[model samples]
Target: MFGSFITMLTGIRILKNINKSLLGIIKYEKPIDKGIEIAGYDYDSVQDIFYSNMNAWQRNMGYSRLYDEASAPFGMIVDCEPIYFKYNNRIWLIELWKGQYDLNTGCEVGVYTAEKPILNLPEVYKYMFYNCASDEDRLTISLSLKKNGKTLFALDDKHWWLAGFKLGEYSEPSELVMYLNITLKDEEMCSSFVEAIKKIGYEENKEFIVNGNTVGLTFDKPHTTQPITRTEQTDKIIQMKNKLLCDKYNDITRVYSNLTDKINAIQKQAPEIYSEIVDKAVLRKYLRSMKNTETE
Candidate 1:
């Protein structure tokens, strides 16, 4: 009972969210002919700076649960190699480049994080079906990841409306197992989306597996062509829509301001003309005088 309690406290826990800003790539070494170097602890002066930044994160968050595992993949950051680091037990990919790499004048580094947590993989899977407009979606009650890094999504036998998730064919060896929900409106749209993925260098069945409902993809390392996330796309569309609305409102305000300024100028410079046009009583008198003058 004591061991069980301890496990509950230390075992895998779902993260509420990941702060990308907390994970930044710092350049510690200049590029040489071979490659740039990620500052190792042995490099005392530079290591201080690296740890100084890392300390900020450590002070803010708790230690990672998977920090000590032999297969955890965290190591000294190095150039030209993709390092898999565990940040709070969530896998992240950090890649460093040498100056020899095209389009880069100096050493550069990049850090990529999973869009969703591993604990949330099942939920992400269900969301995919919902995004697909599938009549149903679900995971089995006994959902578990296999030693071979695979899992199944099954629906209720009696209740078709309940939800259904299925495991499709897979090809790559992946440390991370997850599903991508691509819910395009129609076949043409789906084809375009698939093409977009392919254009970024993903192959069908080898790098990704597709089925009637779910699209299964794995992330052993950072992917060149990432799965299209529905939430991100929606957020982008909303942002763009907001920007356009704001622009339109500003344009309308500017035109209204220009007209208001012209009216005020007339009122100041030509009070009679302004009153004749604007004031009801003055305009009525002006009209009556004009009529009498025309009659004479």
Candidate 2:
């Protein structure tokens, strides 16, 4: 009976050590990224700069969260200050946040319209998307936006004129929403974007809302298109030729000499055909055969 009691004590001690080790990990080993750091600014300076320049709504929201002393048990809560930059002669604001349980951070970017009209709306849209996206996300976002030669507008560039967008977070959808600024002028760019949104199957008052030049748009139901494939034989030939040139060969000069001889042989074999035509045909056939064999 005493031996059994000692065994129970030893098991309890083992569990206690394990529990202590887990607690240490939970306290110190969080997966959060290093906190935000802006160039040429300390922590206190960053806070002061953001607070002084923020709009009333932004000030209220930031301070309310900043001063909150609520306990967070799941993940560490951080109060990050907004950062500013100048693009297209306008001051742009970027606000970052990491919630108590959030594994990844979220950000909202905004910029007031320039006094003068923007010459290129598509360029601005591309810049905004890229600025907010991470390095890994840039290519994906670019391909999605540029798919099928479509911009923010379904219509061609000639048809659209003025366009602006605002980015912010929404609670109900729990995602970033783009609020488009539409103008009533003849060259207004907003109507086309709205029409494009409709074409993609978004509904008014359901997926989006418009309030006097500001259209709050949600992208819950995204439109998918078949991935673009290179179907041109010429393009494929060029790619194969490039690959062949880049490939490691024991004698690159000898390979080129062989290719030239093959071209000459094709010219000799098809004397009736134009010299240019014979040369191109031989090169294309050789590259195509090489590509096929490589695939095999």
Candidate 3:
């Protein structure tokens, strides 16, 4: 009976271990099987599946690795979902996945049609050009204008600079009347910028409508340099002499006041020592006489 009881416990333990193993297998099953053709090409790994759908340009632009890695999976199983967005009067789908397989890890995004037999879809050329124009230091400035509820055109960062002008925008309503402002430090730079814009068919202070908003370009010219006449030069010289004399007099008065304060402090802190330097009665009489003269 003792031997039978031990054999029964051993059988129970074996069953429990088998149950745990099966549960783990079901929990961590690979979502995509090996040799699946989700991207129109057979892929054994998630990255392979993602890259197979990307075109040469997208691959070269490094869109495959542009995803948040902290949320990536650690094991073989991956979570994939489709994101739908409308652009240019057409609906598009993006398949995004996150997981790890062997040494490969992180998330990836790929564009495809929403229908079955998924084929790779390319991003809009204008969006792609503007978005990818940024560098490590300088971000590309872009303006998107829509006319009659449709995209008219987009101006990227290099466009204004190439036209030999720097543009700035204002948020205040008063300044917003001149929507795009071209401000240069000197008159020469302003003139050159004006010429450059005129070459491109843009007129100064011309009003146009963009996206139902009245848009206009305004130029801010620097203050002009003026020549000084002989009389003005003489007046400026006299003003400078007066200012210097006043400044010197003020400095001397400040020094005298500071010395008087120090002497008074010394007299209070060490009266006996101060008495050896000068007679207190004589000092007070002299200060009083000077004060009377100043009042007169």
Better of 1 and 2 by TM-score: 2
For model 1, how does the per-residue alpha-carbon lDDT over 1-296 read when each residue is reduced to its tens digit? 44233223332221111112112221212111001112111112321111111211122221121211111111101113232323333333333222111110112222333334445543232111111011222111111122145343211121111111111111121322333333333454345445545554557887666554334433334444221221244434433433443333333334433434533554455444333222211111111111111112
The digit string of per-residue lDDT tens for model 3 on 17-76 reads 544433443343331221112112222232221222222222223221111111111111
Q: Which of candidates 1 and 3 is the stronger one according to lDDT?
A: 3
- Highest TM-score: give the candidate number: 2
Candidate 3 regions with alpha-carbon error over 4 angstroms: 1-75, 114-296
Q: Write the per-residue lDDT of candidate 2 for residues 1-296, one digit (tens) a residue.
A: 44334334443443454444334333422201011111011112211111111222121111111111110111112222232333344323222222211111122222222222254343332122212222221110100111122222111111111111111110111232233322222223335445655654668998766665445544332342211221245334443432332222212222433433433443345332222222222221121111111112
Model 1, runs deviating above 4 Å: 1-174, 179-181, 210-214, 225-296
Every model: Cα RMSD to truth: 30.1, 29.1, 36.7
Q: How accurate is candidate 3 locally (lDDT)?
A: 0.27
Per-candidate TM-score against the hidden true structure: 0.21, 0.23, 0.17
Q: Among all windows of ten consecutive residues in candidate 1, which has the lowest summed lDDT? A: 69-78
